[model samples]
Target: MFIPAIMAGGAGTRLWPLSRKEFPKQFLNLTSDQSMLQQTLARLEGTGHSNPILLASEKHRFLVAEQLRLSNVATSQIVLEPFGRNTAPAIAIATFMAASESPDNILLVLSADHNVADVAGFQKAILKAQALAENDYLVTFGIVPDTPETGYGYIKCGDPIDDNGQRVSAFVEKPDLATAQRYLDDGKHLWNSGMFMFKANVFLEELKKYQPDVFDYCQSAFNNMQSDHDFHRIPEDIFEKCPDISVDYAVMEQTASAAVVSLDVGWSDIGSWDALSKVLQKDENGNNLRGDAIALNTKNTLIFSENRLISTIGVQDLVIVETKDAVLVSHKDHVQDVKEVVSTLRKNDRNEADSHRQVYRPWGHYDSIDNGKRYQVKRIFVEPGAKLSVQMHHHRSEHWVVVSGTANVYCNGEKKLLTENQSVYIPIGAIHSLENPGKIPLEVIEVQSGSYLGEDDIERFEDRYGRVD
Candidate 1:
């Protein structure tokens, strides 16, 4: 049986203003109502595959589990990484874990942030790769290059290894525009999709051959890993010492067992706004827009407006993204350089580099709709039967006015059932917890007034979601 290893820890900064470090693009509902990660999970259905193992960062552990829960995936398949060490370490750790169940099982490694339009074509390619993987070849899915796309690395096919698979001659880095055009004209290169299928033991053999140090590091870390409910907690100290490297550099580039399968599916990594625009349908004016937007004379532009109405009078070949906390407007050609914006924000210690006005917790989400000096107004939503941590703030006091549903409020040592329009005060140093006691979501307007209204003021004493840290 095949086991999927979903990699979901990328920060995806280039697609920012909507995608942030705290909650990346994979979790966002990019193509439809479901998130990219959820789509990835759903694609595995009816494939006769075992439960997937989700490899994600510590910050996203709960998020990953929650997404899988929404997709109705089994709970035992989630793995948590304390820190990101990229694909090599993650794959190594994952293979080690999979081997514990069965050494001969094939692992299909898929990135969570990708978009595949044709699931049948994808399944065809995966089945072809599975055939090669069963024969001990480490197989990678290579998308048939439609154009001179310099954003992705290319795989030069050497010769036919199987009836449907090709021996990988070499992995080429992102080429120049001219070279990429030549590659497209030659019809011998394919875009590296970063998706692979291999026997767990074959991958481990390659790790031992090409990257023994990484193999040893991950093996030791996995051996020492502890179970945290449904999550597998990687030994932080040991896992952190593992080399920060991608699977391409650490194994596939050096291993002789590498093979590539040509995939004709419409696949996209959705790395930048331009790439996302390509997947979305365009309007009469050639504009791809979401949320509340009005484009008067826009052509070949992607506009994503949230929390407000965005009007574009005469924009062309541009990407305009608006969130509650930040806005990004850039030329479509310069979409790759959007990472520089995140870098500048990081240098200036701006929170926009990390999160948006709406922050998603394990329970639900909170949106800072409006704020002022010494006062901030937030709309908080708690999922049914969910509760925030029992915590106390040292400097700030909060007033929670229930807007809908019912809330169980714990302020100081007093507990009260607060329904719609009921308000409660949580003064400074008073331990409080907010719970959704109703079937629907409990919505409230939280107003804070204090000298310090920073998020760090909270001292959590008890948390049901295991977020004591």
Candidate 2:
């Protein structure tokens, strides 16, 4: 039996503005109607694998659950990391969890934010890798390189192992243009795709052999794991001690059982805007435009606009991305440096680096429409049958005007049913909650007048989602 394990913890800061720390690229539908995470799950439809094991950070637990529900993908487990310790510990925890279910089960490890165009070809590679994995050989899929791309690390292929698989000659780091060209000329090198397959017990044994500290820490974390609803929470303090490293460094690079399977499928990590542009359809002027964008005299450029119309003229080899909260304009050649922008935002303690103007909650979402000194206006949406926590704010008083559907408002033990055009006032220090008791979504325009409007001002007496701050 084979089980899919998706590593979905990346912040994807390089695609900033569109991708943030709160909502990363993996949850965004950059390539299709389905999100990258959904696509990753959908591609395994015909692979006859068991339900997937999703590993995500605690902050993204709701996203993982909601996306999987939208995709109609059934997962065996949703493991939540208290904090990210990189791929090595993440995969180690997955391996331990899977092995507890079945030691013989093969684990097909995949990244959440990758685009694979040819599903058949990808499945074919998985079949070949499964064969090698069944024989206890650790397998990684190597993308057939079509260009001298310096952004990706290269893997040198050795003698043929079995089926189309080859023993890994060596794992090479990202090289200079000249060296990358030589590697392309060699014809034996492939792009390290970072996808892997191995039996659960085999991976655990190899991890224990090569990186015992990581394996031990991960095992302990898993052993002490707690389950809250569908989410599996690992012990935070123990997991934090696991070495911060990738699986490539701790195991694949040192394991003699490592093998590489060549994959010719159209694949991309979408690590940068330039990489994303290659996969999207281009216009007559060789421009990739998405979401209310128009370009004139633009060539080899990517323009993405959300919540606004973006028009560009006489631009070449550029990337312009606009979000509700931030805009990024960069030369295509320097798109890789977009992470530096995120770093600068972090250094300045900017909220745009972490969240969008619209913030998603477990119940639904809220959009900040306008804000000024001591006051803020927000449009909040509540899913049917969902309710906010029983809470109160110390410094802010709020007035909620229902715009659509029905709202059951509870303010300091007074329960009132409100409909369209109706309003309710929540005084400061009044324990209050809002619920959508109707069938359709509940939309409300909330106006807050306060001394402090920070989110940290909320004191939750009770929360259904078990959120505590």
Candidate 3:
């Protein structure tokens, strides 16, 4: 049996303003009603594998768990990386864990941020690749080049090993425009899809052979791994010592057992706005307008409006994305440079570079509605049976008015059960928490007044989701 190992912890900078460090493209509903991660889980149906081993960021544990819960995938295993050590270390860690259970079990590595339209085609490819992997061949799916895409690396097929498998000849880096066109014309080159399948022990052996330090460090890190509820946490100090590198650089390029399976399944990495446009439904003018967007004489344009109505007049070949906090207007031709803007934001220490207006928490979520010099307003949602940490903030006093459902408020040696339209006040430095006791969701409008209103003010004494470190 093969276990799906999903890599979901990427800071998608190219699709920025929409994709942030805190909530990346994998969790966002960019292409369909289901998010990219959910679509990936859905793609696994009928493949005889329902549960997946999830590799996610430490901060995104709640998001991953909640999404998986909603997706009805009950048997997922989440390994939280303290920080990204790139794909090499992440995959190594996963391999060690899977090998512990059964060395011969196959691992189907997938990127949670990728979109695959043809589920049947994708499943068929997985089975075909499984046959090669079972023969101890390290398999990588090579996407049949439909376009001359310079954004992706190319893999040239060597000689056919069988009817379904080919020996990977060359792992080529992203080429120039001319080189990309030539590769497309040659037909031997395929887009490196970054998906792979291999036996867990076989992957570890190849990794140890090519990158011994990575294998050793990850081995030690996995040996010292700790579990928190449904999540597995790695030792930060030891894990950080591992060299940060991509799997292609660490293993695929160096391994002699590397094999290629040319896949024609409709897949998109959604790395840029232009790539996302291909998956979306476009109108006759070649425009994909989502969420209250009106276009006049617009062609080959994609407009995504979140919480606002956007109108484009006589615009052609443009990509405009509007969010609650930031709006990105870029010509689709130069969307690749969006990462430059993200880099500048990181240099400036801007919050928009990492988070959105609506912030998710284990309890539920909170949307920052407004803020001033000394005050902030937020709409908070608490899931049923979920509670915020028993905590205190030194800098801010909060007054919450219940908008819907019911709330169980605990403050400073007292607990009060509050219903809809009721209110409560939490003074600065008061130990308090909010809980949803009803069957439905609990919504509250929280107004903060104090010298400082920041997320760091919370001092947790008790937390169910393990924030009490």
Best by lDDT: 2
RMSD of 2: 1.0
lDDT tens digits, residue span 1-469, model 2: 6989999999999999899999999999999898999999989988899888999999999999999999898764999998888889999898888899889889999999999999999999999999999999999999988899998998999999866699998999999999999999989999999999999999999899999999899999999999878899999889888899999999999999899999989999999999999999998888899999878787898999988999888889999999988999999989989988899999999999999999999999999999999999999999999999999999999999999999999999999999999999999999999999999999999999989999999999988887964
For residues 328-437, what per-residue lDDT tens digits would candidate 3 score against the true structure? 99998899999889889889999898899999999999999999999999999999999999999999999999999999999998999999899999999999999998
For model 2 the local lDDT of residue 356 reads 93
Rank ordering of all candidates by lDDT, starting from the highest: 2, 3, 1
TM-score of every model versus the real structure: 0.97, 0.98, 0.98
Which run of 10 residues does model 1 get worst, by summed lDDT?
Answer: 72-81
For 1-469, candidate 1 gives per-residue lDDT tens digits of 7999999988988898789999999999988899999999887787889888889988898889889889988858677888889899999888988899999999999999999999988887888899999999999989998889998999999889868799999999999999999999999999999999999988998899888889999999989988868889898989878999999999999989899999887889999999999999999988998999988977999989877998988779999998878889999989999889899999999989998888889999999888788999999999999999999999989999999999999888789999999999999999899999889999999999999899989899999988786
List of clashing residue pairs for candidate 3: none
Ten contiguous residues minimizing lDDT sum, candidate 3 = 43-52
Q: How many residue pairs clash in each candidate?
A: 0, 0, 0
* C-alpha lDDT of all candidate models, in order: 0.91, 0.93, 0.92
